[model samples]
Target: MTAPARYPVTVQFGEVNGEPATWAIETLPEALAAVPLGDHGVFIVGAVDPDAFDESDVSVLELLAANAVAAMDAADRRRRLRTYEDALKNVDDMVCVLDGDGAVTYATGPFVSWIGADDLGDVAGRPLDALVDEADAPRVADAVAALTDAATEAGGAPEPTRTVDLTADRDSDRRSRHGELRLSRLSDHGAGVVGSLSDTTDLRRTRTELSAERDRFRRLFDRIPDPVIEVVLEPEETVIDGANPAFEAQFGVDETTLRGRTIDALDIHDDRLGDP
Candidate 1:
């Protein structure tokens, strides 16, 4: 049987004919078509005979090549995915990805551990806000909605940082956790949000304690009989930064009047004046 024109050789893929051909071979159109009429019909042009080639032998070779290509493609895809997964896992912040409907698509390792989940499988594809307490679920939804809208409006620049307060079931009790959430728009037009969730229970408690302490200090300072003065020591600048109510009453002074006034001009017991 006549053969087609001698095809080129590929380093990884052997030549189409016994004789050497061009270094480059087109895969899609040029390589596949070899005909005397330049049509789909088979024509004899090559120095070698393809008839001597066994059907099974050629089949096996093609199959192996196809399988190799498929495997390589799959490996490349997996590697890319793994690279992203590793990046997400290494991040200290809780990173979560969600679909347009607020369903969880991918969640990082931190979130799984933070929520005490063995893996993301349980949460994957689930409505993320469902995990939140009913009282807070609506808020989570709202934040997600706002983030989505903002991203759409910004042409996917990235949603601005927002603080979301949500309740999670931790140790069998509803615990409030504050998260700084940032949303990103996915190529598929879905949205993904990633940020850190810090257990702010301690921070809130500390703030409350500090507030109480401040109130206590204010009460003590206000009740003291002697006029306790707080001066801006540096620059020798003294505008009453703070004045106790007692200090005001004793001097027949209003606290507002005491503020922003030079100490030298103020009337005080002359005995207290000293060389500065």
Candidate 2:
């Protein structure tokens, strides 16, 4: 076989000749009929006979190519889905497919492990809301109901996708896991809901710790005895954002009113302000 050539269409053409040629040929074929199979490459058939290839032959090839493309497309989709499932298996997040009634039709391996289930069958057919913490169950239900209502209002059109943060009730020692639940309608007709629950427990804890740290710093800063003022450094000059209680008492002006007012606007004697 020869390398595929791109002309009117991509194809690989070759011929087998012998002392007693079984297949009689008047001329060497230039191109062969072919069909693309996505990333799997092209499927090439017998070489085209320019003289014998008529409109009827063209129709046959077209039909065959159409079927081949469809099959290839389906196979490609399954391959991609397998790859996605494999990736999700190792991830901390859980992927799930829900039916119209919000029942779990399919779930990733992580979900099964998190729930302490032997397999997907343990969770399958269960209401998705049951897996959520009792505190978050109502919120999850409301979100799903709203999507369903919106789809109905739109005359069966797909509802807009939305994401919500909720806690999942796990059977493991973890007990509960904070997750961001991304919910979306699977089809244009709103046939079902597809969602992914990404574990955000660590992220939420980090944010909470950072917030507490910030509050501690603010308390310490405000309690300091020295006259302290926060200023915004500008290209032309500096503007006061706020001043502590000591500075406020010395200046005889409230920090709120002093804010946004430039230091130059203040009455200073003996160039004391220049010392800073």
Per-model TM-score, in order, reads 0.56, 0.57
Which portions of model 2 show Cα errors greater than 4 Å?
A: 1-93, 115-118, 149-158, 169-175, 231-241, 260-276
Candidate 2 lDDT, 1-276, residue by residue in tens = 553344343332444573332444434565566656545567665555556556787678778777877676556545554565566567666787666667777788876665457788888898777866678777777566555544576576445676878876665665466778888765443346668777788899999899999799778778898778888999999999878897776656788888999988877465453355
Worst 10 residues of 1 by lDDT: 30-39
Candidate topping TM-score: 2
Cα lDDT for residue 178, model 2? 78
Model 1 Cα lDDT, one tens digit per residue, 1-276: 333355442433455668644445322122221223212223322223335445575565556655655565555544554555677766766777765567776777777666557788988887767865677677677666656544567565445445666545565466545443444444323244443456566777688899999999888988897777555554876666677776676666777777777677578886554344
Name every residue pair that clashes in candidate 2.
Answer: none
TM-score of 1: 0.56
Indicate the residue-level lDDT of 244 in model 1.
Answer: 79
